[model samples]
Target: MNNSNQTLTIKEQLQACRSKEETFKTLVTLSKILQRLSSEEKTDENKVKGCESAVWLIVEESNGIRHFNADSDAKLMRGVLVAILSLVEGKAAKDIQQMNLKVELAELNLSSYLTSSRTNGVLAILSQLQQP
Candidate 1:
């Protein structure tokens, strides 16, 4: 299903995957949903830190709503980024700031799948998004 047509929230989507095989399939689906950007938008200024691979994130606010654009050198990392972005993209800054990322990640079973460094990287991306 297309992202716009997807009825399930990211948490619901992850929660639907009851087994490791299911989770793997979900991750692959998430990865395919990620859209790559142009090289100009993938510069160092947009780069996310604490990640093992190079990850870049850019946020644009329009009419008080935030839109996120991100890219990563690693395919799996890009999928992870997609999962992270699904939480707050198109949300207001206050909403994004108020979000409990740890809780969200836990609900999605992401914390179990990610290494500490990868988790930190996701946090870094969220931090950038929360900025004014």
Candidate 2:
């Protein structure tokens, strides 16, 4: 399954994974998707701090659109990155600034599985996006 059909939101994707094994599949699928980004697009400017593994992101702000390019080494961490993408992708930076990832994660029921450090990493990515 190519999981790239933008028809389903990341939250919806996570919701579709009702079992532990299914969730693991979702994580692996996300990692596969993110790995498509090129090396130059990956940088410290894009890195997410505090994660249990490496995750980098490039937030493209162009003509009022926010596009996210991200990658992660940890499979479970990839799901965490997707959680962040769920909130801000396709929005303007102004709209992204208004987003509270904490609330979004809570709504998605992701906190139960993610570690505190991993949660901080997601928040850090959003904080990086908040930069001018």
What C-alpha lDDT values do all the predictions have? 0.74, 0.68
The residue-by-residue lDDT of candidate 1 on 55-127, one tens digit each, is 9888877898877778788877776777778777777888888988767767776655687777777777767
- TM agreement with the true structure for every prediction: 0.87, 0.79
Which residue pairs in model 1 clash with each other? none
Candidate 1: C-alpha lDDT: 0.74
Off by over 4 Å in 1: 1-7
lDDT by residue (tens digit), candidate 2, 32-89: 6554457886677666776667888776667887677777767777766676676666
Alpha carbon lDDT at 72, candidate 2: 76
